[model samples]
Target: MLTTEIREAFLPYCLPDITDEEVNEVVQSLKSGWLAKGPRTIEFEKKFAEYVGAEHAVAMNSCTAALHIALLSANIGPGDEVITTPMTFAASANTIIHVGAVPVFADIDPETGCIDPDEIAKKVTPRTKAIIPVHYSGHSCDLDAIYEIADKHGLFVSEDAAHAIYTRYKGRMIGDNPKGAVSYSFYATKNLSTGEGGMLVTNNEEIANRARVLITHGMSRNAWNRYAKGGSWKYDIEEPGYKYNMFDIQASLGLIQLDRLEEMQQRRAQIADRYNRAFSELAAVKVPTVSEGTTTHSWHLYVLRVNPAELRIDRDQLIEELKERNVGTSVHFIPVHLMTAYSKKFGYKKGDFPNAEAWFENIVSLPLYPSMTDDDVDYVISSVQDIVHKFGK
Candidate 1:
């Protein structure tokens, strides 16, 4: 039982661990005069590719853009069906619709909240063109099973690695393999912070090359080269494309963030370990799991599942109680299928995905950013323990 008083200050669910290094890099990029898709962006791309052991990495304005362009480059449009999990942010499925494809929602594994390969197999059809598996909460989906299913159907797999910067699957990084395109987010709340930016990584030269062209309005060359000395004024629009290019300003932050990634990630891991140890003995709380020796979870979000049957209060009540105690909490998602946009378009309702719906009701993401102090971690843990004990049935 926790005896400490409720915290005096509020602790947000997540915060970017920015420092003087990130600020200095951004300032340097600003002073360089060439901000939009310049040298820093190029260097960021290279460093990011090397970090993930990917053959190529293309920087974009957002992870949504990365997914859209990745699907577009793979020729997934019109009559295609892209299979993904509903237990994710809207961007995962929205990108499928954006590329004129249908978003097929597969149920998730109740334990890990990842799309079940079995469900994915059942959803496959003649029109199925690709699979976009989100590394939900930085826990890598079962790559062996997902890839095996994709192989059997001859489908493309574009990974929504938005939450998985440091996640490893079967001893290899998510994007390290040549099987498909993997998109990573460097959003303000992501494991790797860049304010707002994303990267699309793949081993396929064709996909990488096409993605580059598609991000810059389908131009033959990027803006930096077009405006540089000895550059030709003439350019050609190869295809109608969107303005998804990431700027040097964002890349500057990304470079420094990438450099400090391991250090920050270690801090996140330490906090997660503390949470796991503290919560393990609580019957009403279920901590997130990892695959032991086979994979490395990035610990981006420390989501806890409340056993409603064992509690006097429900998940929503738990969140409210935590907030009342000055600890911020959030649901990783509301299950994309249940959202107004997807529900209306796909004709989905509450019971459509029972696992996701049930999981959605109980899961809560606690404050788990690298910037959090040990006291912050303790406050969150003690608060949760206190609430559960007070409300336990």
Candidate 2:
């Protein structure tokens, strides 16, 4: 049934799935009074490490911080190059620059929107020190092929797993047994959020220890509780670093969210399944394709690529129609290489990465979150199909 009704209330594109338990956790942290970056944050780090099967985890203020630390901990600095996809957020590339390294752009696998390993190989050079393959929209990149390239070139691998916390590569969790480091986002819209936080997980002790110091204003160990009862007040700055440590309040939320991750993820999966069934066979639409080796997808963003060639309306127009129909939408990315800063700095321009450019042109991210009800999901589906029927060639 094509729902001819427009919702009275406008559905948001995304929302944080916070429960009363999360609220109580924050209240408990506030009541505890030791709220800087204390017990709760440390506990979150430990629990997160265990959940992802990583030997160590360092919670940070943002995924960008983790990415910067990943490069810095490995001594990737000036005169070095880090290859990453232009199909991701600017932070993925910007973090490489933050570490005083050049960010080399690689085109994406058009079908999957993930960085192409072959393109990554093509971009590698004598100065290439690392590769930051983004797990685009919760579909794990071809880690096996990517790591093989890194091994051949003796390059470090810092995975941009902002969208892949629950994604599985070859039946292993995205953060499990990381090659170098895996950075995850905890932004309000992420699958597992702490309002605004991130975590860096790694099996390498050197990298993990370095990240802890780097994110805490370079304060030495044993100084974290310097203000506590019978605690030492002395510390040393190992090196100049950033103030990017996660706070207790955020971790308060994280602790509760982690406990409910599976429950929330099930809802996201159901919504994604609804979307796939609705659009996969539609003539003028293309649903996201879970790439090979991705044994499980996190269903972070249900990105639907509209075929403008077969539709009377294009991507932008579809967005407008959806808005009028009381459904909100977003775009996954605008391709980092095409952004003003990248173009002005690297002399990059459109036509540089044709596949990414084409993918961007036809894509619109529909709302996919645990908070949405079944009625909401069906309404969104009907709205999209109605538009297709009205506008299709």
Candidate 3:
């Protein structure tokens, strides 16, 4: 019913909420002359671990690197099968492969768009070494059920918590449980932005120690330790490792972002609530559901599902119409199983995971970020409503 004029410029799906605080921190890091793997990185790790109530946290270059290192540290390799959902970013599965492990595809919950515990239970075998359950779109997966399954089968659980910066399940933060490794992303568009960085949290002392060594090229000590005053140059390479250490420049941004995370998350929650309220009334669209009183959704992405049967236009047409109205949108994922790399490498096909494929056909991620203004939120809502009205069957 809104008749407001269309936005003159395109509205992006998401944007980092950078402020003078972040800029000042980065400037300070630059002026310090210790830009890589220095004091700032260590401080970020400590603060982030405390924030998530984790026993240990290791900073890395990316969430993919964190996952790869976690898998390697767990000794998961060839002939091992790691179960995961197809309805996720490819990095979730690719890291399993990077460690020479096979990624066993599991279908998602039709409603939650998260990995289904039932499907995971069905896929477990003697070859199963771990389960990489992604907290899809910042909604916590059924961790209790997943953990129960893991306990019964003696399987490791490495949470791909790229979208779950502040998400909680059963009154505890996602990384706090720490029975296994939990990886978080501070990607450009995440709830917490560091431009590019990640962290791995775990309760296992051995994994923590190994991750520390592995992130710094398997060196016995990091550069900051050797280069600082009263430092020793003597070091040793304990094992082969990847160059996954996070730099102080990125950590400087992370520190500022972390300081502002709660405020930013509040804004995101408001946007999500507004979107849910507005979209729930539309016949053609289904709003995302949150598990009331059970989990805290990070609200990282407000994914709306279009019931193609009720709309004359399909998901692609909906996206096009929104774009024409200067409203940006995106699909959370295309389902990892359908990607060429997975299909060609693993012999997966179109119908290998039915739920994921079906869900992929109708989901659209709306513009949700702390940077968006109230007018921007209204513009997106009105645009979507206008498009649905024009295209509804």
RMSD of each: 1.1, 1.0, 1.1
Alpha carbon RMSD to native, model 3: 1.1
lDDT of 3 by residue, 224-260 (tens): 6688787888989998888999999999999999999
lDDT of 2: 0.92
How much lDDT does each candidate structure score?
A: 0.91, 0.92, 0.91
What does the lDDT read for residue 343 in candidate 1? 78
* TM-score, model 1 to reference: 0.98
The digit string of per-residue lDDT tens for model 2 on 306-326 reads 887789998999999999999
After superposition, which runs of candidate 3 have C-alpha atoms over 4 Å from their true positions?
A: 1-4, 292-294
Q: Count of backbone clashes for each model?
A: 0, 0, 0
What is the TM-score of each predicted model, taking all chains together? 0.98, 0.98, 0.98
Quality of model 3 by C-alpha lDDT:
0.91
